[model samples]
Structures are given as C-alpha cells and as structure tokens.
Target: MPEETAKQTHFYSVEAPDGSYDLRIEEMLARIESTAAPIYMRLINGKIPEHQDKMDMAQFLAVMVVRTPGSRKDAAEMVGRMIQIRNYATGVHDRAFNSLVHRIEQGEGRQLTEESRTSLRRSLIDPSGYRLELGKEWALQHLTAADKLTPVLFQMRWRTIGAAQGFFITSDDPVVRWVEPKTWHPIYGDHGYLNKTAVVTFPLTPKVMLAMSWEDEGANAFAGRQGVDRLNRLRALQADEYLYAHLDHEVIRRMAVATKGSRPRMTTEGFGPKKFAATTLRRGRANRPS
Candidate 1:
C-alpha cells in the first residue's frame, strides 16, 4: 500500500484552570457540536464532494462522546463503539467503490480507456488526503488518553481479552481462532466458538486509544520530554514480565482516577453466530480466498 500523505495541522489543548470537570466537558462538547453541525449539513445537502465528509462526522461524534464527562469508563466504551462504526463505514465505502469500478468495466466489455481509468482512480484516492488530515487534527485535539499509563492499561485489556478468548483477536491474520468452545449449563451441551477466528476480526479499540494518546502526548510534551517516542519505549518495557507487572498496578491506579465511577457496559453485541466462518468455508471449497 502507498504511504498515507503527511498531515499538516495542530490542535489546541483545552486545560481549564478551575479543574471543574463539568466545565471541561461542556467546553469540549460545545466545540465538537459546533464543528459538527456544518459538516452534518454539508453531508445532508450532498454538497461535500467526497466520502471524507461522512468520515469526519463519525469521528467528530466519537470525540464528542468520548470527551464528555460522565464516566471515563463509559466514554471509553462509547469510543470503542464509534471506532467500530468508523471502520465499518470505511469498509463499505471501499466495497462500493470497487463495485462501481467493476460494473463500469463490465459495461465497457473491455478494459477501461486510459483516461477513464485515470479518472476513476483519482476519484477513489484523492479524497483520502483531506480525510486523513482532518482525522489527525481531531485525534490530536480530543482523543487523548490522559497520560502514559493509560496506553499500557488499554493494552492490558486487549491482552486479557485475547488470552481469555484463546487466539490473538487483533492480529491481521484471517484464520486465527478467536472464540473458545464452552458448554453453557442452560444449554446442556450446546457449544461453539463465538466470532470469526482471525486477526483484525474485531476493531482495535484499545490500539486506537493508545495511538491517540501517543499523538496527544507527543504534541503536548516539552521539547526533549521524549513524547510519543516515550510511548514506544513503554511498550518495549511492557514485554518484560517484572516491568509490566509493576506498571500494571500503576495503570489500574491511574485508570481509577481517570475512569472514576464508570462501569464497563457492553457497547454492542459481539459479532453474531459465526456467519463469516460459513462464508470462509464456502470460499475455501471453491478455491477462492474470502
């Protein structure tokens, strides 16, 4: 894949001196809501020229909900759901573009004329530049993860889920096992794995948080404070069992401070009934990749 274009932008930090959490929330909410309105209108009017407008709306809402002060835990959960929706929307856009190109090719009954092909390619790729720049700005402004400990804690949750589920849930591999088999007492023997067994099967909510945190911190820290590079170092340190165990306690403490009063709520149901497995099996039988 081609490297994504370089982003040029900056996000102002919002630090209210009174330390009143509600005030902070209200300010951020106002900013997001105000920014989102015009974008939403543009989308509704069909005046925006690209899919980036749609993505900007999704991302803006995600930031707004996550930054809203209620329960940090709830906000985190909401952010996770938002990320999943954004990922799904991006996938749908890609499929639609591909389908359009395929139909055009079919209609032509031959390869596309060079000029036509160039136009189609430009139509598909040009808009991503603006979207990525906007996304970077939003992430820097509102998607911060509190502090350094937050990323480690987020990673812990991911690791725990993967361990309990018995396969790497966030890997890009398509054939990894995701769900484990168990007999529910109520069912008296009914058992099967839950979601598709594959890397990248689920949205990388924790990773997104960590990445955002890194960006925020990197942007804010003083020169020589070691910024996002510091995050990379922490990840390396986490590989050491003693280091990780020691830091885990710190992460829990910080999360308590950050997430205070928020309880884990299931944002959405996990992928239902392993339908993807059947599709994958069929593709295999047909000697095709899913």
Candidate 2:
C-alpha cells in the first residue's frame, strides 16, 4: 500500500480567477452563439437575403466552429479576428489600442505604447481576464508573438513574481524560451531534422495551471499516451476523422462519455527545484546501495 501510494502522483489545485472559469467560458460561448444564431435561422428558414454576403457568413460560421467545446485554439484565432474586425468597425477612442490592432492586422507591426503594452504583458502572464485560448497552436503563436513585441513589459512582470512561479519550465536551450523545441517534429521523412519538443506549463495564477506537450514528431503517438487521453478524445470528436476513416462507434461513444460533464477546474503541481533535488538525491542513494 505504501509503495502504491508513493507511485501515485498528485498535482496542485489551482482555481481560476475568482472561481469564474465556467462563467467566463459560458459567457464567451453565449456571445458567439448569439452572433451566429441569426445567420443559422436565416439559412434554416430559406430566407436567402440577397444582401447577405456568403463570404462573410462563411467566416462567421468558421468562428462558430472554433467556439464549440474542445475548439480552444481555433476559437482563440477566430476571436482575435473578431477583435480585429470590431476594432475596424468601431473607431477607437484611445489611439493606443487602435494603433496596436492596426499594426497587427497589417503586415507592418508597430510598437506598443507603454500602457497598452503593459496590459498585454499582464494578460500573457496571467491569462485570466484575457480569453485567448491556449489549446490551439495558432493561439499560442499569437500570444508568443505579442509578448515578443513587448519583451520589457513581460520581463518586468515575470520579475515581479517569484522565480518558481512562472508558466514556462526553463531549459538549457534558448529556443525553449518560446515554445518547447522538442514539441516541433518533422512532418515528412525528408523534412530533415526535428527539434526537441518540451511540455509547456501555462499557469493561470497562484494555484491553477495547464500543461500541454507540443511536438512535431509523433503527435499521434504522443496523443495516445494516457496523460493526454482526455484531451485527445475531445480533439478526435471535434476533428471527426481518424487517419483516413471516421472514428469507430466505440471511440465516438467514449468521446461523448468523456466530454459529457462540465469543464473541470485546471490542476497544478509543485515540481520545482526543491522537489527535483530531493528526488534526485533519493534515487542516487537507492542506486548506490547493494
């Protein structure tokens, strides 16, 4: 029993801001649904309004697809696009937000104002009030890119927090600063060497954090690992395809079962320098003995 218990690992309990994760997600979903419902109703009723731009409607539909449960990254990109569109549609009262949004929208990126940049830094590090989805690669890319533009602000925020409290797990490699190098894998055999991928830990705050292992190599194989089963199940249902064919009935059934409940609070574990050093010493002594 002691051995069994020792092998069982536990993560930290990190609650979302004000315990409002569900409320926030629900609000985002409702807003997206409201935006899309009218378009769907028009299509269902066969009221083909001539003024309705199919292209715009298609984009809106894409937005809807991304917002559905388990579509975090897609939703985040769609939301980013939506934010851009809104900025364009509504003239900005503050020149700062408008400028930053315009530069991002245009290929020509611009420098962020100290105040606006500070806010973005806080958003990237905390990621609480900000609704950008972390599950998607594109969303992570955007967040990373945004952070780069305001490195000073980000560094300042990081420094304010204790060293052990940040989201990323530092490594010897510099590339690990962005996304984990190990996460990048070769898509094709002839594509050349693959990079080392690392698991990125996204800390929500003092307690809650989510870790995602992004890799270019053997994504399918990695997804099969037990730790990622729940996430993979959700993604499979959303994707609706396995290799070439649709999922087996049993797989679909399992996926449905897995996703039936409400979203649970994220889990965090304290595995810092202290824990690492302690574990290493214990293993060394055990190995040295007869």
By summed lDDT, the worst window of 10 consecutive residues in model 2 runs over 276-285
For model 1, the stretches where C-alpha displacement exceeds 4 angstroms are 1-25, 46-55, 64-290
* Cα lDDT, model 1, residue 14: 27
lDDT of 2 by residue, 1-290 (tens): 65545541111112244642223434544565566467545543333222333333333333432333233333344544443334333332356545645665476565556776556534433333433222232332232332232222111111011113212121111011133335544442221112223332222222222232324232112122343333333333334222111224454456556544433221223321111110111111111110
Error of 2 at 31 (Å): 2.9
Per-residue lDDT for 43-134 in model 1, tens only?
Answer: 33324323444344444535533343222334433443444344334334767556666777899787777688556655333323222111
How accurate locally is residue 98 in candidate 1, as Cα lDDT from 0 to 100? Answer: 64
Q: In model 2, how large is the Cα lDDT of residue 165?
A: 23
RMSD of each: 21.4, 23.5
Q: Which regions of candidate 2 fall more than 4 Å away from where they truly are? A: 1-18, 22-25, 49-56, 68-290
